[model samples]
Target: MISIWIYATLFLGFMVLAARSDARDLRISNRLTLTMAASGLAAVGLLGGGAAALLVAAATGAATLAIAWVLFEFGWLGGGDVKLAGAAAIWLGPEATLAFVLATTVFGAVLAVLLLVLSRWDMMLEMVGSHWRTRLTADTISVPYALAMAPAGVLAILARFPDLF
Candidate 1:
Protein backbone atom coordinates (compact mmCIF):
# COMPACT_ATOMS: atom_id res chain seq x y z
CA MET A 1 0.00 0.00 0.00
CA ILE A 2 2.76 2.39 0.94
CA SER A 3 4.63 1.39 -2.19
CA ILE A 4 1.56 2.24 -4.25
CA TRP A 5 1.44 5.72 -2.79
CA ILE A 6 5.12 6.22 -3.45
CA TYR A 7 4.69 5.00 -7.01
CA ALA A 8 1.78 7.34 -7.61
CA THR A 9 3.56 10.27 -6.02
CA LEU A 10 6.72 9.74 -8.05
CA PHE A 11 4.80 9.36 -11.28
CA LEU A 12 2.66 12.44 -10.63
CA GLY A 13 5.56 14.59 -9.52
CA PHE A 14 7.70 13.76 -12.57
CA MET A 15 4.76 14.21 -14.92
CA VAL A 16 3.99 17.65 -13.51
CA LEU A 17 7.57 18.67 -13.94
CA ALA A 18 7.69 17.31 -17.49
CA ALA A 19 4.51 19.16 -18.42
CA ARG A 20 5.83 22.43 -17.02
CA SER A 21 9.16 22.06 -18.78
CA ASP A 22 7.56 21.13 -22.08
CA ALA A 23 5.13 24.05 -21.85
CA ARG A 24 7.84 26.56 -21.05
CA ASP A 25 10.55 25.38 -23.38
CA LEU A 26 8.78 23.03 -25.75
CA ARG A 27 11.20 20.37 -24.51
CA ILE A 28 11.13 17.46 -22.08
CA SER A 29 14.56 16.75 -20.65
CA ASN A 30 16.00 13.29 -21.16
CA ARG A 31 17.07 13.22 -17.53
CA LEU A 32 13.48 13.65 -16.34
CA THR A 33 12.14 10.99 -18.72
CA LEU A 34 14.89 8.52 -17.84
CA THR A 35 14.36 9.02 -14.13
CA MET A 36 10.63 8.53 -14.54
CA ALA A 37 11.15 5.22 -16.38
CA ALA A 38 13.72 3.95 -13.92
CA SER A 39 11.61 4.88 -10.93
CA GLY A 40 8.58 3.14 -12.43
CA LEU A 41 10.51 -0.13 -12.73
CA ALA A 42 11.72 0.27 -9.17
CA ALA A 43 8.20 0.92 -7.97
CA VAL A 44 6.95 -2.21 -9.72
CA GLY A 45 9.59 -4.32 -8.00
CA LEU A 46 8.77 -2.74 -4.65
CA LEU A 47 5.11 -3.53 -5.16
CA GLY A 48 5.96 -7.23 -5.55
CA GLY A 49 4.15 -7.27 -8.85
CA GLY A 50 6.65 -10.01 -9.80
CA ALA A 51 9.03 -10.43 -12.71
CA ALA A 52 6.21 -11.01 -15.17
CA ALA A 53 4.65 -7.66 -14.39
CA LEU A 54 7.99 -5.90 -14.72
CA LEU A 55 8.65 -7.60 -18.05
CA VAL A 56 5.22 -6.68 -19.34
CA ALA A 57 5.71 -3.06 -18.35
CA ALA A 58 9.12 -3.02 -19.98
CA ALA A 59 7.79 -4.55 -23.18
CA THR A 60 4.94 -2.08 -23.28
CA GLY A 61 7.37 0.77 -22.87
CA ALA A 62 9.57 -0.59 -25.63
CA ALA A 63 6.66 -0.95 -28.02
CA THR A 64 5.58 2.59 -27.22
CA LEU A 65 9.09 3.84 -27.92
CA ALA A 66 9.20 2.07 -31.25
CA ILE A 67 5.86 3.51 -32.32
CA ALA A 68 6.77 6.94 -31.07
CA TRP A 69 10.03 6.74 -32.96
CA VAL A 70 8.10 6.17 -36.15
CA LEU A 71 5.97 9.19 -35.36
CA PHE A 72 9.11 11.20 -34.79
CA GLU A 73 10.51 10.01 -38.07
CA PHE A 74 7.37 11.19 -39.82
CA GLY A 75 7.84 14.59 -38.21
CA TRP A 76 4.56 14.22 -36.31
CA LEU A 77 6.09 14.22 -32.84
CA GLY A 78 9.18 15.78 -31.36
CA GLY A 79 11.99 13.65 -29.92
CA GLY A 80 11.24 14.81 -26.41
CA ASP A 81 7.60 13.93 -26.83
CA VAL A 82 8.59 10.46 -28.00
CA LYS A 83 10.82 9.91 -25.00
CA LEU A 84 8.23 11.24 -22.58
CA ALA A 85 5.47 9.07 -24.00
CA GLY A 86 7.62 5.97 -23.84
CA ALA A 87 8.58 6.67 -20.24
CA ALA A 88 4.95 7.27 -19.31
CA ALA A 89 3.91 3.95 -20.87
CA ILE A 90 6.19 2.09 -18.45
CA TRP A 91 4.26 3.47 -15.51
CA LEU A 92 0.94 2.75 -17.21
CA GLY A 93 1.77 -0.92 -17.90
CA PRO A 94 0.16 -2.81 -20.80
CA GLU A 95 -3.59 -2.25 -20.40
CA ALA A 96 -3.51 1.35 -19.21
CA THR A 97 -0.87 2.18 -21.82
CA LEU A 98 -3.47 1.72 -24.54
CA ALA A 99 -5.81 4.10 -22.73
CA PHE A 100 -3.01 6.61 -22.30
CA VAL A 101 -2.21 6.61 -26.01
CA LEU A 102 -5.84 6.99 -27.04
CA ALA A 103 -6.56 9.69 -24.49
CA THR A 104 -3.37 11.52 -25.35
CA THR A 105 -4.28 11.51 -29.02
CA VAL A 106 -7.69 13.00 -28.24
CA PHE A 107 -6.23 15.58 -25.85
CA GLY A 108 -3.54 16.55 -28.35
CA ALA A 109 -6.09 17.21 -31.02
CA VAL A 110 -8.21 19.32 -28.66
CA LEU A 111 -5.19 21.25 -27.46
CA ALA A 112 -4.10 21.98 -31.02
CA VAL A 113 -7.52 23.28 -31.95
CA LEU A 114 -7.74 25.40 -28.80
CA LEU A 115 -4.32 26.86 -29.42
CA LEU A 116 -5.20 27.69 -33.01
CA VAL A 117 -8.38 29.48 -31.86
CA LEU A 118 -6.55 31.34 -29.12
CA SER A 119 -3.71 32.32 -31.45
CA ARG A 120 -6.20 34.07 -33.70
CA TRP A 121 -6.94 36.45 -30.87
CA ASP A 122 -4.09 38.96 -30.88
CA MET A 123 -5.35 40.56 -27.69
CA MET A 124 -5.39 37.25 -25.85
CA LEU A 125 -1.82 36.55 -26.87
CA GLU A 126 -0.69 40.02 -25.88
CA MET A 127 -2.31 39.79 -22.47
CA VAL A 128 0.02 36.96 -21.60
CA GLY A 129 3.76 37.49 -20.99
CA SER A 130 6.15 37.92 -23.89
CA HIS A 131 7.41 34.35 -23.61
CA TRP A 132 3.88 32.97 -23.97
CA ARG A 133 3.10 35.49 -26.68
CA THR A 134 6.03 34.17 -28.67
CA ARG A 135 5.00 30.58 -28.09
CA LEU A 136 1.37 31.14 -29.00
CA THR A 137 2.05 33.46 -31.93
CA ALA A 138 4.84 31.50 -33.53
CA ASP A 139 4.30 30.78 -37.20
CA THR A 140 5.19 27.10 -36.74
CA ILE A 141 2.58 26.67 -33.97
CA SER A 142 4.32 24.05 -31.90
CA VAL A 143 1.90 22.41 -29.48
CA PRO A 144 3.16 21.96 -25.97
CA TYR A 145 2.14 18.33 -26.18
CA ALA A 146 3.21 17.40 -22.67
CA LEU A 147 0.33 19.58 -21.49
CA ALA A 148 -1.98 17.13 -23.23
CA MET A 149 0.04 14.10 -22.17
CA ALA A 150 0.01 15.03 -18.47
CA PRO A 151 -3.76 14.95 -17.97
CA ALA A 152 -4.15 11.79 -20.01
CA GLY A 153 -1.32 10.23 -18.05
CA VAL A 154 -3.06 11.09 -14.79
CA LEU A 155 -6.27 9.50 -16.01
CA ALA A 156 -4.35 6.38 -17.08
CA ILE A 157 -2.70 6.19 -13.66
CA LEU A 158 -6.06 6.44 -11.90
CA ALA A 159 -7.56 3.84 -14.21
CA ARG A 160 -4.67 1.48 -13.56
CA PHE A 161 -4.80 1.95 -9.79
CA PRO A 162 -8.39 2.74 -8.98
CA ASP A 163 -7.98 1.50 -5.41
CA LEU A 164 -5.58 4.35 -4.73
CA PHE A 165 -8.47 6.76 -4.64
Candidate 2:
Protein backbone atom coordinates (compact mmCIF):
# COMPACT_ATOMS: atom_id res chain seq x y z
CA MET A 1 0.00 0.00 0.00
CA ILE A 2 2.78 2.39 0.94
CA SER A 3 4.65 1.38 -2.19
CA ILE A 4 1.61 2.20 -4.29
CA TRP A 5 1.41 5.70 -2.89
CA ILE A 6 5.11 6.15 -3.44
CA TYR A 7 4.67 5.08 -7.02
CA ALA A 8 1.77 7.45 -7.47
CA THR A 9 3.72 10.34 -6.01
CA LEU A 10 6.69 9.66 -8.22
CA PHE A 11 4.47 9.30 -11.28
CA LEU A 12 2.64 12.56 -10.64
CA GLY A 13 5.87 14.34 -9.84
CA PHE A 14 7.38 13.33 -13.17
CA MET A 15 4.23 14.32 -15.03
CA VAL A 16 4.24 17.76 -13.41
CA LEU A 17 7.89 18.25 -14.22
CA ALA A 18 7.39 17.20 -17.83
CA ALA A 19 4.41 19.50 -18.24
CA ARG A 20 6.25 22.46 -16.77
CA SER A 21 9.32 21.91 -18.89
CA ASP A 22 7.30 21.50 -22.07
CA ALA A 23 5.17 24.56 -21.32
CA ARG A 24 8.22 26.71 -20.71
CA ASP A 25 10.24 25.67 -23.78
CA LEU A 26 8.21 23.01 -25.59
CA ARG A 27 10.94 20.54 -24.80
CA ILE A 28 10.65 17.41 -22.66
CA SER A 29 14.20 16.26 -22.01
CA ASN A 30 15.32 12.74 -22.88
CA ARG A 31 16.72 12.31 -19.37
CA LEU A 32 13.38 13.04 -17.79
CA THR A 33 11.44 10.66 -20.04
CA LEU A 34 14.00 7.88 -19.57
CA THR A 35 13.88 8.32 -15.81
CA MET A 36 10.12 8.15 -15.88
CA ALA A 37 10.18 4.90 -17.83
CA ALA A 38 12.74 3.33 -15.53
CA SER A 39 10.90 4.38 -12.40
CA GLY A 40 7.67 2.92 -13.75
CA LEU A 41 9.27 -0.44 -14.32
CA ALA A 42 10.86 -0.31 -10.89
CA ALA A 43 7.57 0.57 -9.24
CA VAL A 44 5.83 -2.39 -10.88
CA GLY A 45 8.51 -4.76 -9.68
CA LEU A 46 8.59 -3.28 -6.19
CA LEU A 47 4.82 -3.71 -5.92
CA GLY A 48 5.18 -7.44 -6.60
CA GLY A 49 3.63 -7.27 -10.03
CA GLY A 50 6.08 -9.96 -11.19
CA ALA A 51 7.61 -10.61 -14.60
CA ALA A 52 4.33 -11.03 -16.46
CA ALA A 53 3.00 -7.66 -15.33
CA LEU A 54 6.27 -6.00 -16.20
CA LEU A 55 6.17 -7.61 -19.65
CA VAL A 56 2.66 -6.34 -20.24
CA ALA A 57 3.63 -2.85 -19.20
CA ALA A 58 6.66 -2.94 -21.45
CA ALA A 59 4.63 -4.16 -24.41
CA THR A 60 2.08 -1.43 -23.89
CA GLY A 61 4.82 1.15 -23.75
CA ALA A 62 6.32 -0.16 -26.97
CA ALA A 63 3.00 -0.09 -28.77
CA THR A 64 2.37 3.48 -27.61
CA LEU A 65 5.81 4.48 -28.84
CA ALA A 66 5.16 2.97 -32.25
CA ILE A 67 1.81 4.63 -32.67
CA ALA A 68 2.92 7.98 -31.32
CA TRP A 69 5.96 7.83 -33.54
CA VAL A 70 3.71 7.66 -36.55
CA LEU A 71 1.89 10.73 -35.31
CA PHE A 72 5.18 12.49 -34.81
CA GLU A 73 6.28 11.63 -38.31
CA PHE A 74 3.11 13.18 -39.63
CA GLY A 75 3.81 16.38 -37.65
CA TRP A 76 0.77 15.79 -35.44
CA LEU A 77 2.92 15.54 -32.32
CA GLY A 78 6.41 16.44 -31.18
CA GLY A 79 9.15 13.90 -30.50
CA GLY A 80 9.11 14.75 -26.81
CA ASP A 81 5.39 14.28 -26.68
CA VAL A 82 5.71 10.84 -28.27
CA LYS A 83 8.39 9.75 -25.80
CA LEU A 84 6.49 11.17 -22.84
CA ALA A 85 3.29 9.41 -23.80
CA GLY A 86 5.11 6.14 -24.24
CA ALA A 87 6.71 6.50 -20.82
CA ALA A 88 3.37 7.40 -19.27
CA ALA A 89 1.74 4.35 -20.84
CA ILE A 90 4.26 2.16 -19.04
CA TRP A 91 3.19 3.60 -15.70
CA LEU A 92 -0.45 3.26 -16.65
CA GLY A 93 -0.19 -0.39 -17.71
CA PRO A 94 -2.36 -1.98 -20.45
CA GLU A 95 -5.84 -1.41 -18.95
CA ALA A 96 -5.26 2.12 -17.70
CA THR A 97 -3.24 3.01 -20.79
CA LEU A 98 -6.39 3.19 -22.89
CA ALA A 99 -8.01 5.51 -20.37
CA PHE A 100 -4.91 7.68 -20.36
CA VAL A 101 -4.91 7.92 -24.15
CA LEU A 102 -8.61 8.76 -24.31
CA ALA A 103 -8.36 11.34 -21.56
CA THR A 104 -5.30 12.84 -23.19
CA THR A 105 -7.12 13.14 -26.52
CA VAL A 106 -10.05 14.93 -24.91
CA PHE A 107 -7.76 17.25 -22.93
CA GLY A 108 -5.72 17.91 -26.07
CA ALA A 109 -8.82 18.95 -27.98
CA VAL A 110 -9.78 21.29 -25.17
CA LEU A 111 -6.30 22.77 -25.18
CA ALA A 112 -6.46 23.33 -28.91
CA VAL A 113 -9.73 25.20 -28.53
CA LEU A 114 -8.29 27.29 -25.72
CA LEU A 115 -5.26 28.12 -27.79
CA LEU A 116 -7.41 29.16 -30.73
CA VAL A 117 -9.36 31.48 -28.46
CA LEU A 118 -6.22 32.88 -26.88
CA SER A 119 -4.55 33.48 -30.25
CA ARG A 120 -7.15 36.07 -31.06
CA TRP A 121 -6.22 38.07 -27.98
CA ASP A 122 -3.00 39.88 -28.78
CA MET A 123 -2.90 41.64 -25.41
CA MET A 124 -3.27 38.37 -23.57
CA LEU A 125 -0.58 36.77 -25.68
CA GLU A 126 1.79 39.65 -25.01
CA MET A 127 1.31 39.26 -21.28
CA VAL A 128 2.32 35.63 -21.50
CA GLY A 129 5.98 36.55 -22.19
CA SER A 130 7.87 36.71 -25.51
CA HIS A 131 8.48 32.97 -25.76
CA TRP A 132 4.80 32.13 -25.61
CA ARG A 133 3.72 35.18 -27.55
CA THR A 134 5.87 34.19 -30.49
CA ARG A 135 4.71 30.59 -30.41
CA LEU A 136 1.08 31.56 -30.12
CA THR A 137 1.38 34.04 -32.94
CA ALA A 138 3.11 31.67 -35.30
CA ASP A 139 1.49 30.58 -38.56
CA THR A 140 1.35 26.99 -37.28
CA ILE A 141 0.34 26.38 -33.70
CA SER A 142 2.42 24.10 -31.53
CA VAL A 143 0.85 23.10 -28.28
CA PRO A 144 2.61 22.04 -25.14
CA TYR A 145 0.93 18.66 -25.18
CA ALA A 146 2.41 17.61 -21.85
CA LEU A 147 -0.21 19.83 -20.21
CA ALA A 148 -2.89 17.46 -21.46
CA MET A 149 -0.81 14.38 -20.79
CA ALA A 150 -0.22 15.23 -17.13
CA PRO A 151 -3.82 15.69 -16.12
CA ALA A 152 -4.92 12.71 -18.19
CA GLY A 153 -2.29 10.63 -16.44
CA VAL A 154 -3.67 11.70 -13.08
CA LEU A 155 -7.16 10.74 -14.11
CA ALA A 156 -5.96 7.38 -15.42
CA ILE A 157 -4.13 6.72 -12.16
CA LEU A 158 -7.23 7.51 -10.15
CA ALA A 159 -9.41 5.36 -12.37
CA ARG A 160 -7.00 2.46 -12.12
CA PHE A 161 -6.73 2.67 -8.35
CA PRO A 162 -10.21 3.59 -7.23
CA ASP A 163 -9.44 2.26 -3.78
CA LEU A 164 -6.90 5.00 -3.33
CA PHE A 165 -9.72 7.44 -2.84
Candidate 3:
Protein backbone atom coordinates (compact mmCIF):
# COMPACT_ATOMS: atom_id res chain seq x y z
CA MET A 1 0.00 0.00 0.00
CA ILE A 2 2.76 2.37 0.93
CA SER A 3 4.49 1.45 -2.27
CA ILE A 4 1.42 2.50 -4.17
CA TRP A 5 1.58 5.94 -2.64
CA ILE A 6 5.26 6.21 -3.47
CA TYR A 7 4.60 5.22 -7.06
CA ALA A 8 1.78 7.69 -7.39
CA THR A 9 3.92 10.46 -5.97
CA LEU A 10 6.82 9.65 -8.24
CA PHE A 11 4.57 9.56 -11.28
CA LEU A 12 2.92 12.85 -10.47
CA GLY A 13 6.24 14.50 -9.64
CA PHE A 14 7.82 13.56 -12.94
CA MET A 15 4.72 14.50 -14.88
CA VAL A 16 4.65 17.92 -13.30
CA LEU A 17 8.32 18.49 -14.06
CA ALA A 18 7.82 17.41 -17.66
CA ALA A 19 4.83 19.70 -18.06
CA ARG A 20 6.74 22.66 -16.67
CA SER A 21 9.76 22.02 -18.85
CA ASP A 22 7.64 21.65 -21.97
CA ALA A 23 5.77 24.86 -21.26
CA ARG A 24 8.89 26.86 -20.53
CA ASP A 25 11.37 25.44 -23.01
CA LEU A 26 9.09 24.08 -25.72
CA ARG A 27 10.96 20.81 -25.24
CA ILE A 28 10.66 17.72 -23.07
CA SER A 29 14.10 16.34 -22.31
CA ASN A 30 14.75 12.69 -23.10
CA ARG A 31 16.42 12.30 -19.71
CA LEU A 32 13.22 13.19 -17.90
CA THR A 33 11.10 10.90 -20.08
CA LEU A 34 13.49 7.97 -19.66
CA THR A 35 13.65 8.46 -15.91
CA MET A 36 9.88 8.67 -15.71
CA ALA A 37 9.51 5.47 -17.75
CA ALA A 38 12.00 3.58 -15.58
CA SER A 39 10.50 4.75 -12.32
CA GLY A 40 6.97 4.09 -13.54
CA LEU A 41 7.86 0.52 -14.54
CA ALA A 42 9.47 0.03 -11.15
CA ALA A 43 6.45 1.38 -9.39
CA VAL A 44 4.00 -0.76 -11.28
CA GLY A 45 6.13 -3.86 -10.75
CA LEU A 46 6.62 -3.12 -7.09
CA LEU A 47 2.88 -2.84 -6.79
CA GLY A 48 2.48 -6.41 -8.08
CA GLY A 49 1.93 -5.78 -11.77
CA GLY A 50 4.93 -8.03 -12.55
CA ALA A 51 5.74 -9.05 -16.11
CA ALA A 52 2.35 -7.93 -17.31
CA ALA A 53 3.36 -4.40 -16.45
CA LEU A 54 6.49 -4.70 -18.54
CA LEU A 55 4.60 -6.11 -21.49
CA VAL A 56 1.88 -3.54 -21.28
CA ALA A 57 4.32 -0.66 -20.99
CA ALA A 58 6.32 -1.92 -23.95
CA ALA A 59 3.27 -2.41 -26.12
CA THR A 60 1.80 0.92 -25.20
CA GLY A 61 5.06 2.74 -25.85
CA ALA A 62 5.50 1.10 -29.22
CA ALA A 63 1.94 1.85 -30.28
CA THR A 64 2.19 5.43 -29.17
CA LEU A 65 5.46 5.81 -31.02
CA ALA A 66 3.85 4.64 -34.23
CA ILE A 67 0.97 7.05 -33.87
CA ALA A 68 3.32 9.83 -32.85
CA TRP A 69 5.34 9.26 -35.98
CA VAL A 70 2.34 9.99 -38.13
CA LEU A 71 1.47 13.04 -36.12
CA PHE A 72 5.03 14.25 -36.44
CA GLU A 73 4.95 13.78 -40.20
CA PHE A 74 1.85 15.89 -40.42
CA GLY A 75 3.52 18.67 -38.39
CA TRP A 76 0.94 18.16 -35.66
CA LEU A 77 3.50 17.14 -33.02
CA GLY A 78 7.08 17.75 -32.06
CA GLY A 79 9.71 15.11 -31.51
CA GLY A 80 9.80 15.90 -27.82
CA ASP A 81 6.06 15.48 -27.65
CA VAL A 82 6.39 12.10 -29.34
CA LYS A 83 8.99 10.91 -26.87
CA LEU A 84 7.04 12.23 -23.92
CA ALA A 85 3.81 10.58 -25.01
CA GLY A 86 5.55 7.26 -25.67
CA ALA A 87 7.11 7.35 -22.22
CA ALA A 88 3.84 8.34 -20.63
CA ALA A 89 2.07 5.49 -22.40
CA ILE A 90 4.37 3.12 -20.53
CA TRP A 91 3.10 4.45 -17.26
CA LEU A 92 -0.50 4.35 -18.39
CA GLY A 93 -0.27 0.81 -19.82
CA PRO A 94 -3.02 -0.84 -21.86
CA GLU A 95 -5.99 -0.53 -19.54
CA ALA A 96 -5.76 3.23 -19.07
CA THR A 97 -4.09 4.02 -22.38
CA LEU A 98 -7.33 4.94 -24.12
CA ALA A 99 -8.37 7.21 -21.28
CA PHE A 100 -5.00 8.89 -21.31
CA VAL A 101 -5.19 9.47 -25.04
CA LEU A 102 -8.68 10.85 -24.80
CA ALA A 103 -7.71 13.20 -22.00
CA THR A 104 -4.67 14.36 -23.90
CA THR A 105 -6.68 15.00 -27.05
CA VAL A 106 -9.28 16.98 -25.17
CA PHE A 107 -6.68 18.97 -23.29
CA GLY A 108 -4.68 19.60 -26.45
CA ALA A 109 -7.71 20.93 -28.23
CA VAL A 110 -8.47 23.25 -25.36
CA LEU A 111 -4.86 24.34 -25.14
CA ALA A 112 -4.82 25.09 -28.83
CA VAL A 113 -7.87 27.26 -28.50
CA LEU A 114 -6.44 29.00 -25.47
CA LEU A 115 -3.17 29.66 -27.24
CA LEU A 116 -5.04 30.94 -30.23
CA VAL A 117 -6.92 33.40 -28.09
CA LEU A 118 -3.86 34.37 -26.11
CA SER A 119 -1.79 34.89 -29.21
CA ARG A 120 -4.17 37.53 -30.40
CA TRP A 121 -3.75 39.47 -27.20
CA ASP A 122 -0.63 41.56 -27.38
CA MET A 123 -0.63 41.89 -23.63
CA MET A 124 -0.69 38.14 -23.13
CA LEU A 125 1.80 37.50 -25.88
CA GLU A 126 4.19 40.15 -24.60
CA MET A 127 4.23 38.79 -21.07
CA VAL A 128 6.70 36.11 -22.10
CA GLY A 129 9.02 36.91 -24.96
CA SER A 130 10.66 33.53 -24.71
CA HIS A 131 11.13 31.35 -27.76
CA TRP A 132 8.41 29.03 -26.55
CA ARG A 133 5.98 31.89 -26.32
CA THR A 134 6.90 32.89 -29.84
CA ARG A 135 6.33 29.42 -31.11
CA LEU A 136 2.98 29.30 -29.35
CA THR A 137 1.91 32.64 -30.70
CA ALA A 138 3.04 31.89 -34.20
CA ASP A 139 0.37 30.66 -36.54
CA THR A 140 2.58 28.05 -38.14
CA ILE A 141 4.16 26.01 -35.37
CA SER A 142 2.67 23.42 -33.08
CA VAL A 143 2.10 23.98 -29.39
CA PRO A 144 4.06 22.25 -26.65
CA TYR A 145 1.78 19.24 -26.65
CA ALA A 146 3.45 17.74 -23.60
CA LEU A 147 1.57 20.43 -21.74
CA ALA A 148 -1.59 18.45 -22.37
CA MET A 149 -0.05 14.98 -22.35
CA ALA A 150 1.50 15.17 -18.86
CA PRO A 151 -1.55 16.30 -16.91
CA ALA A 152 -3.76 13.86 -18.74
CA GLY A 153 -1.29 11.14 -17.89
CA VAL A 154 -1.64 12.12 -14.22
CA LEU A 155 -5.41 11.95 -14.44
CA ALA A 156 -5.14 8.51 -16.03
CA ILE A 157 -2.86 7.36 -13.23
CA LEU A 158 -5.24 8.68 -10.60
CA ALA A 159 -8.14 6.96 -12.29
CA ARG A 160 -6.21 3.70 -12.33
CA PHE A 161 -5.87 3.85 -8.54
CA PRO A 162 -9.06 5.47 -7.41
CA ASP A 163 -8.90 3.81 -4.01
CA LEU A 164 -5.49 5.30 -3.43
CA PHE A 165 -7.05 8.65 -2.72
Candidate with best lDDT: 2
Query: What are the per-residue Cα lDDT tens digits for candidate 3 across 11-109?
Result: 778878988998887888989988877776776667775787678787888898789889999989888888777877777777677888899999999
Overlapping backbone residue pairs in candidate 1 total 0
TM-scores of all candidate predictions against the true structure:
0.94, 0.96, 0.88
Candidate 2 yields a Cα-based lDDT of 0.90
What TM-score does structure 3 among the candidates reach?
Answer: 0.88
* Per-residue lDDT of candidate 1, residues 18-135 (tens digit): 9999988999999999998998887777777689988988898899999999999998899989998899988888888888999999999999998898889987887878887887
Report lDDT (CA) for all predictions: 0.87, 0.90, 0.79
Over 4 Å off in model 3, which ranges?
A: 130-133, 136-139
lDDT of 2 by residue, 68-149 (tens): 9999999989999999999998888888889999999999999988988788887788778788788888998898899999
Candidate numbers, best lDDT first, in rank order: 2, 1, 3
Q: Given candidate 1, what's the lDDT at residue 153?
A: 85
Query: Local error of candidate 2 at 68, Å?
Result: 0.8
